[model samples]
Target: MEQNLPVACVDLFCGAGGLTHGLLKKGIQVKAGVDVDPACRFAYEANNGGAVFLDRDVESLTAEDLASYFPRGSYSLLAGCAPCQPFSTYAKGKDTTQDAKWKLLRSFGDLVRKVQPDLVTMENVPQLPKHAIFNEFLEAFDGYHTWFEVVECKDYGIPQRRRRLVFLASKLGAISLIPPTHEKHISVADVIRDLPEIKAGETYPNDPLHASASLTEINLKRIRQSNPGGSWQDWDEDLIAECHRRDSGKSFRSVYGRMRWEDVAPTMTTLCYGFGNGRFGHPEQDRAISLREAALFQTFPKTYQFIPKNERANFTVIGRLIGNAVPVRLGEVIAMSIADHLKMVNKAEKKAN
Candidate 1:
């Protein structure tokens, strides 16, 4: 019945269309995606069922700009995951209150008040609930019922140990995320075991995005000694970096480590393409996981295209895009939650009438 109703959505800060793609898969009609990065335009528009990509900053987006994307009498859903770097656990001890990125949530709240959409959703780091801005964002939903919680992506069948804060608000009575879909957690091998192998720095001719970053001799040696789920401690004393030898650096154990085949992957970050960035190295191969592997770990489809055919793949650019995206599976969970909420609301209305 949600399909019979024109349930249109406008995705804000829609990087590479991850959320839009997932919503589309779950039967939501995404009319447009607004993001400041022009680099995301091609992937966003190309993969998201021809949804228009608006290259505009969320700070500059007005109610009029977003409302135009939804059809008259349609159920309008506004969704976004504001850039999370400022609030990430990695940003510990840094002063982010003064950061301009801090105010983007305020802008999102402002638009919600102006547009008064039928539904709203947001995804962010688990730490966001601790900030004042999060409370400010909630003020935008005075008349709407809201539910938010930190969710484990692995419980939702995502093959990564990513924990994110998911928020839902609706003018339609009550709302919450749907129940977890997986009892047995998905594992690393379960997702990427079938992809053909490529050595470090080697690109599979058939898929440029499957390329891995080249490792220096010492780093390669370190990776070779690294055991699955083991850290730098497994390396020879001679192979240990000077920083890791010191007392302060010993606490940073996950760097230059390998993921276990049977367990979920560690959280993917912007620098996850590098062997030394967290436990990103392959369990059996003597190299970091390729870009394609990282994307698959993020629950992106195997055929998900990141760059145009003419353009050479830049690991940093594509890595950031993939790392920062709302995992496609998590996005589907969010969309399903909304679908269930709509169904309940529709049933109630019918019974009352």
Candidate 2:
């Protein structure tokens, strides 16, 4: 655990390398990131510099497969932020337990048991801890000291109000996430107000990812009428959707709203680039946020590359990568906490000796 001792990490379910980027920023040596999405290879390797990306599913990954990338005798950290859609509140009433994705957490736990890494960490939707698989994952940490909390990403300097369940376990000793870095939350204007403007369906000539989703005439009109921080209620009665006229639809108010400049943006979901999904409309623009803006809200750097120079940007593929990513800032906080935990344990051992 000493500063001189080597610490290496292998990120499982490493979509687009958000967590890996954060760990590397904090000086942790991340050897590789593993995931099934071939689309992520470019972004993951391109932005993370030296980290390798293994395009494979976690279910098929063996202890040996992971061991091949890690150094022998180095303190190893196994980190996985398994897909959260199965356990998300939005998926309620569906048979989540029967879903194939439900087994992913168990697979992650099994690998931890086999690899027996010095540390383990996971991030997921805040509702994840209520599921039985979560408890099963904790059981895998039998001898390790573990701590978990539903953390607000804004408190950690992320410019979005994303609430996530974060778990950290250490064989060395007790561990927790780093303390909040910002007493004042970062706002939407703080992150994306400076980007060049583009019309719906137009890509900035200089930045490929800055392209906005094309809006239909009706949608464009809707967006123009939408007020920042206001719900569907702010729309003209004639412009309101047919669904909103029903008694049942009155309760669903967050959709088709614009983000407020002074407030933190809502959680970015996989479809965040579309105005109809959540409150994704741009505060001043007449279109939904661009892909680049969505990634920025997820705390990815402005320069994080999601596509090759010659390749055209694909909204679905890139949006999923950005939305599913663990906010890079949150990942940094986790890495710093692990580093401090190791330092504390090392100091205690030196005193005891």
Candidate 3:
């Protein structure tokens, strides 16, 4: 197993490093990382191999810079996940392409085409059954042996009902994603039940990583009316916002909702902290889900500590990173799949020789 290990990996758009953490867990060396988001510097480095983080955007990654991150002359594996917000169908009517973020994947592909690593991988939201960008990407890789699959997170033992599209390609030899583990599903309670109770806006006394976000008084009232596994429809007519009474407003019922302890959480967005966004309320608690709970729902290990002695636990910062991250568990699946593929390639070459 030690002999099969790849020398190094460079994570582009590393974010807070749910992917980096997964890479490290499989004994893959993450040499250097890059991301535009400054919020990631502390936690990405804190948890994943203490890598050097370049705060530059992925578009700026040079072939030479990527070359330096790998071993002198060995198998080169390059991994990057471009920002996914623009392609998301949720913002369909909202002019997603108007934003500069949509061009990031093409920029990432530029680097991929230049560096031409032995292996490449990327993950993104399932751009609804629409969108030509995904098809364009496939045509771009016309000559390469590529495999793209829309993997449901539960099939790979993530427990959460997340559906993501993952792509893997190789020049070293034919490689495929790791077959799903599909052992058993982890429940909402399985991940967060052990955490100590913190009222809305309360932090854990002993472990700062366990700290929850505080609730404003109005937000607290909103949570009280929300039911676990229930939507804004549960709110009395008096509590309903004036717009909610209208047809257009009724469509927003998924907001200000509580999670079912027995079921998995809805996909966590970057703004999971807001009570009015997504089904994020805490079960049996009168507040939106805590930062720690959100992290757990994202499949971060309960014992996964972010800050050390010198740092203060800021929920706003951690929450954003955790919420925005590729779930560490999801990363593990990708990493292991890459490792397994490389192993198969090596064994095949040995047999042919």
- Clashing residue pairs in all predictions, respectively, total 0, 0, 3
Off by over 4 Å in 3: 1-7, 87-100, 128-130, 139-143, 303-312
Candidate 1's C-alpha runs over 4 A off are 1-4, 88-99
Q: What would the per-residue lDDT of candidate 1 be over residues 172-204, giving only the tens digit for each residue?
A: 889999999999999999988888898999988
Q: Candidate 2, overall lDDT?
A: 0.88
Per-residue alpha-carbon lDDT of model 3 for 51-147, expressed as tens digits?
A: 7788987877788877778876566667767776644344554544344556787777777778777777888877622555555555546456788
Please write out the lDDT profile of model 2 over residues 164-220, one tens digit for every residue: 889999998989887889999999999999999999999998889998999998888
Clashing pairs for predicted structure model 3, backbone only: 201-213, 201-214, 201-215
Any runs in candidate 2 off by more than 4 Å, and if so which? 88-99
In the predicted model 1, the residue pairs found to clash are none
Q: What is the TM-score (0 to 1) of candidate 1?
A: 0.96
Please provide the root mean square deviation of candidate 3 (C-alpha atoms, Å). 2.8
Q: Judged by lDDT against the true structure, how good is candidate 1?
A: 0.88
